[model samples]
Target: MSQLYVAVLAIIVAVLLAVALYRATRVKTKADYLVAGRSLPAAVLVLTLLTSWIGAGSLFAGAENAYKNGFAALWQPAGGWLGLLLIYFIAPRARKFAQFTLPDLLEARYNQTARVLGTLAILFAYVGITSYQFKGGGDVLHLIFPDTVSSQLGTYIIALFVIVTTALAGMSSVAYMDVAIGSLVTCICIISAPSLLHQAGGWSALHSSLPPQYFEIFGNYRLSPHGVLQSPAMGLVRALEFLVPTMLLMLGNQVMYQKFFSAKSERDARNSVIGWIIGTVVLETLIVAIAVFGRALYPTGEVAQHPREIIPYTARHGLPAILGAVLLGAVFAKVISTASNYLFSPATNLVNDVFVRYLAPNASNKRVLIVSRLAVVLLGCWALYQAIYAESILQKMLWAYTIYSAALTPVVLAAFYSKRVTAWGAVAAIASGTVVTLAWDLPGVKSLFPHIISDRDAIFPALFVAIAALIIVSLFTPAPSEAQLAQVAE
Candidate 1:
């Protein structure tokens, strides 16, 4: 059975590599490498967007949340669903402002300082995200070949393959490969969810076997022995911690914006979001359901101990042979798809925002392409290093999400909607947000105000400081000039 799963995964990797190689041959210019020549249609855009957004974050971290918290886990993804509502209004405008990377938009609307600060924040957030995808892929590989492959070895294998594949054709390969992978994973999850429920003896069995709190919204606190139900405010705070970061990340996700830049037209970009919202809602709900069912089926043992592995463990032991193999393959491929998208985004930032913009404004297309590939290899190694030391998938996911949410989202949204936001204010927002988030959990800093910082998640403080800086500083300073405002004007 393990060998069958390995064979399916091996086949998927081969097909992905072949597609990547074919796409590599089509790369000719900087635009071709970074934005797929700005020619992707709505159909392709939808799948790529869906695949990029639903990653190890969904498969591992999200599954872990479901295993532990039940339906209340939906609060995390509910944030993304809400962000998608706002994105429907922003997508067409983003396409109209097409550029290579988010930093490009930042510089146009803010200043060079804001652009550089934004780039740094993106690197911190995105590299952390890519690292966990490596970790998740490694977990799946170890599961499939446990006798011979340790999780550490699996991490190295996944890192090497993802780096090489991402360096091959850039956005063209990533986007097209997603079309294949996203379809497989979406179909498999749709099938696996109902199948797993039936095998678990249906929803009636699930409710009876699991804690009754598992079925309630915000039931996360209710399961605790201390019974925090006495403090509903704390429950709301806990739920908001999950909700805000996911929503903010979606609103300002550079990966999503880059895909919009790749779209052939504004219509394509807007249309893609409609499909993306539907796919995301359906897929995320299924992921949580599958995880909850898997928990009920396997009440104890290894999976119960390491809840992050529930999805893959269910694939190996819970499902039938053929479906299990395919579902396992989908999990593996989705991780790679996400890692490539994230790894490629930061590389795009370094090459387009720093190297090409400042270091070699006159560099030839050939030279830029070479540097682009090199950046992917270097950043991928950085992500692999972080993966090596990472402890929990859900912890890493929230940390990365909060960094991007607090640091970049405020300034990015201001650029699109407010002419009163001056460049210095944007810089202040980015700097304060990044610093507070990174420092909020440190032992020394938490000790300074243990009551406020120790127990609370960083998103609340980080986002507050960021927004306050943006609004207060902008009000004190002169309004942005017409020139600055014009850059982002719709």
Candidate 2:
């Protein structure tokens, strides 16, 4: 990577973040810090959601998939398409019944117990999710200048920057920054996608490079590295990634739904999902192409040469310097924007769901504000440490997704879709999902799922077991009161 180009990009990101840091005020109320007082316009909503979802998962893991599977890596973005399809149907309902979080939704539907458990599930995922962004951001810094920045320090720097941003103004600042960075990335990707495609000798030339299997949606993927399908049944795992978590996202996830609550109007919420569908398909298509054709440029073993840096490798070497700088900044922005959004989330939940609800229900808003800020610092430091030391970006991202999806998805579905669920059902689902995800990470199970299937695809089994446990428990027990059903129906 060109030092000048990388420096220019870093300088640009630093300035944007610096501006946000200055925008934060002393918290007048928790609302001021957490949701920007529920006043985001359509454009800001679109941008914040886009950037928040597109980070390490889209750029790094997407590239890694492209490198390993050729065009077969399109599955990652395809999943997004399905997710957006889900949001289209799900978002309006979520907006209509707006609340601060996934737990907020559960509390509305079930009770205080559901809210607390849901908070625990989300924070569990938030920690893991935020940690991976730190992991990816550190990788970007190292890629740009491996000689100067140690990976650990790089991770710490990224984490610290995110912590500072989140600590300030919280989601209010996050929403504004997302609007700016989101537009930059979308426009840059649109301008550069054709350029990369043209440089890769066009579609026909690109087609000449890969084996025929790369074109198939699920081709080259098997239960093992030996390249043999376990069975058509095993393919269920891939589909479930799109199908299952999507159900969870629509039914379970609160952070994105919180955006809906914050939208200036219901029409704004609808348009935000529309923008998301269009932008996501285009942006992800180009990102996957960069990795696919990048392989046509520098196929295997280049990742280890600069594993995290390989993305800039493709951009810097593949595109002209100006375009290279723009896309690289977009990539880095993905790293920072997403991390900043999530880093603040767990802290908000820690304060609202756990601390205020149980620890000090009568505490002053001033005390809540102080604890929220402090929680952001404590959680930020822990996630940064995990990002730097615990595992690779891929590992951290999957661990977080599985833990949260498993723990929360079922309880969420039962809350929104089925009133037959009891509090025990929610607790059972959360516990089962958390335990299964944790156990899946033990040495024996890791050897099976992630290598054969990326964490993107592997978490379905745990997610299912968690939901199934919830249902089975609900089947044997009494149902929640009609009051709970009426709340979710709203």
Q: Please report the TM-score between candidate 2 and the true structure.
A: 0.91
- Over the full model, what C-alpha lDDT does candidate 1 score relative to the true structure? 0.94
lDDT of 2 by residue, 1-490 (tens): 4667668776866766675776575347767777777778888887888888888876886677666666666765675577678677667677777666677777777667768777877777888788888888787776667689877778888888888777777878788888878888889878876787788788898789877656766545544445666664554455455435434543455668778877877778888998888887788787777777777777666564544455666776778888887777777777888888788888878887888777998888788878888998999988876776765565565566667777886777666677688877787788778777777756677767656433444477777787788889888988888876776674
- What tens digits encode model 1's per-residue C-alpha lDDT throughout 1-490? 7678868988999999999999999999999999999999999999999999999999999999999889999999999999999999999989999999999999998889999999999999999999999999999999899889888899999999999999999999999999999999999999999999999998788889998878877767443345545366666778888999999999999999999999999999999999999999999999999999999999899888889999999999999999999999999999999999999999999999999999999999999999999999999999999999999999899999999999999999999998788888999999999999999878899778977775567898899999999999988988888987887777
State residue 54's C-alpha deviation in candidate 1, in Å. 0.3
The residue-level lDDT of candidate 2 at 264 comes to 76
Q: Alpha-carbon error at 201 in model 2, in Å?
A: 1.2
Task: Output the lDDT of residue 285, model 2.
Answer: 84
Largest TM-score belongs to which candidate? 1
